[model samples]
Target: MTTIEAPSGRTTTPDVQHIDVLVVGAGISGIGAAYHLQHEQPGRSFLLLDALDERGGTWRTHRYPGARSDSDLFTFGYGFKPWRGPSIATADEILAYLDEVIEENDLAQYIRYRHRVTAASWSSEERRYTVEVTREDTGEHLRFTTDFLWMCQGYYDHDKPFQPNWQGMDEFRGQTIHPQQWPEDLDCTGKRVVVIGSGATAATLIPAIAESAKHVTMLQRSPTFFISRPKVAELAATLRALEIPDEWTHEIMRRASFAQGEELWRMSVETPDALREFLIESMRPLLPDGFDIDKHFNPTYRPWQQRLAAVPEGDLFTALREGKASVVTDTIERFTETGIRLTSGEELEADIVVTATGFDLSLFGNVAFTVDGEPVDFTQQVTYRGIMITGVPNMAYVFGYFRASWTLRADLVSQFVCRLLTKMDEQGTPVVVPQLRPEDADMPLLDWSDPENFNPGYVMRSQHRMFKRGDREPWTHHKEYTEERDILPTADLDDGLVYRR
Candidate 1:
């Protein structure tokens, strides 16, 4: 946020806001970045811009029934702030946590809500970015100039979810709903609900709606790994019984989760077959006797191929055992008047159909970028520590870890950005860009296109659009939080980057 005057020699007006550092999106990443900027670089002036009217990003936007944390809260929460509650938390609980962070950190004064960014133009002459945005309330256009642009809006398109082109979808008489657009007056009581796509959304919704819905059937083209977890925290309880503080308990639990996740990946590489069997057998008792574990629970891919969805209190399995819920692993042939017809020659009746499909993942929230009035294609660039694109200067985007808590990486990114700015201050440098080495051109490139590499459905669909990763750092992501933790914090900025005054 260290700055001089605008290089264009333009004077600031009432509608024009001049900032040293502007962090986009007021969600988890933006808030964390703001905190780091305030604490680490106290002299820098900054503000947060969110497209929505409020903050809390995903947690605030997704309010579907049974919407909660799929990952443990201890790690999901900010490193500075302790969750100090259940392993998995509801959306409201998380939103409240974020509110508390903002209130305690006094972030409210710096946040300018309802500023939907449309495009950004980087001016080499000015050494600044001219950001164009629209005020949602009045549709008024405003401009802002900033020394550094931090994209913390996340990597997904919030405008729409991915909906497959299914035949006869419009002909169905039953109500069709997408979890991303869940209605406030949605009536599922005593109704037959068919939740489609067995990802986190389906896993969360089926059990939640099963309590009141006459019957809930989870229909998926392919099965996903679902692991049931108890509501109580055994480790935490034991630790607190011995008089240890809740904060200490949270740290211990966090590290334990990290180690377990790393071990699971290791097992996947060494003994995938045995590990798969072990995981399937672990869930046998939860379901009714003689259940087909291979067909419904076991995914076609090897274990750790994708993230496992965590279910609370074994509610999903209990619902299945008590015959209140069922799962169907088949392709949707078409939609009938009263239900959906499967390709396996089966028709299931449903009063309401919820498409719990994945998101339309986009890089930098689909922000249009122009360097010196020329549009930049990020796909041709290499990422630096998965934070900054090679050709993009004085900009960093926050992309969290896939396996572990997202904030774990966000926390590191915040620290790195702060240090980067401080180093720039000391060196009298105003610009930093990743400069690919000469030999890097001969080095092989990697993409997240294949499921074997990084097989999340969301990424697979948009792999071609994302920036390429090299075989090694600061251009590649190892996908392991432990390795990233060891590398990113102390990673040298000049390794593949160029600094300019």
Candidate 2:
């Protein structure tokens, strides 16, 4: 821990004391919260603690052979930090970028690495939170309290990988791997591979494994409806220009690109049938001539009902079209001697198997939260603009838009939260809570995650209840910035957010 002078010209320590804010998790969201909190409110004291020794939550944990961002770099990057590299950035590059941002902002002083927060209990009488954390390296437990608690801890538990129960999965002779916990020593040189799951992980894994594997078959219980488009060069270029010091140019292109994504999202939901057919047609050439598009591409649910895989460089489609990658729409009954046995009474042999099945959506580590020692379950809570979980006060969690670059939404959420905190101080409000009214509860939460909902990962599970049903634009996720601004701006804080004494 390093020390820095607060705005009041006093020495300050982020840890070992009651802070203005206690942010859990050192991932992008946590970093964003800490960065903005310090930059915008230097006088306010806050501490960022992570269970892991280092930052970069998901990006740090899941480092498979070909890990990279499928979303455009411009949109994927933090608003405060400009992504100067090519449109696509590798996992390592992203992790480096995160570290760079922390260093540039002098945020390391506030971060306590290897400190895992076990449980948090809110004190209504004190109007504060008491948190319990364990040091991973020292094996010592410590207790601390803060005026507010921010659950920046991402949705997945590091120990729990979403491994589905395949009947014969244990009997497989070939090695089995999950991308989340990919082993460093594992190699797939000239090996025949079978990747289970047709979601983002499978899409990314198939292409990378194709380069080294003799053959890689993407075995999906059903076909996933994916959409592809050219790299948003215009958007990227526009963001680059805005990253300059000039505020005018920055605001112009920022609003433009934001509105553009919003328009696209609107177009997607308004004309579902034509767009759905167009998407199906777009995929026809990549599949076998007589392949059943209806069975594979024609999902049972509506479009954007679950996440639509982004084929930025068409890597997955390129592999399929080049005969290097193939998709098998079959159910895996269990693990076979060398591969997977399908429910169709057939066997596909492989040297290794990768399960990209998906994730579990248990919010906050399936851990218990208590206010004044009374239990508080996030599932029993409502999300405020998908940020701060209701019934929790003076704290905020920043996540990305389901349809857009996560950072885009994260950036906005960070800004809004900082402004909210500032507003609270200005108004002498000690506590703020965004509680949804009964009428608002009648509104829908969209689930743009995996339709099948088999894997219980964080993002998918959150999406399952994050948005209103059928209200795709604002409720689910708005890829566009224009619409998001209207809903996320500081002026809209009065919608239902309550500021308590």
Per-candidate TM-score against the hidden true structure: 0.95, 0.84
Give Cα distance to truth, residue 53, candidate 2, Å.
2.5
**Which of the numbered candidates is closest to the native, going by highest lDDT?**
1
lDDT score, candidate 1, position 91: 88
Off by over 4 Å in 1: 1-14, 448-450
Per residue, candidate 2 scores C-alpha lDDT tens digits across 289-380 of 67677876677665665667766567788787777878788777778777888889888999899888766644664445787667775545
**Steric clash pairs (candidate 1):** 385-474
Q: What is the C-alpha lDDT of each candidate?
A: 0.85, 0.72
Worst 10 residues of 1 by lDDT: 3-12
On TM-score, the candidate that comes out on top is 1
Please report how far candidate 1 places residue 33 from its true position, in Å: 0.8
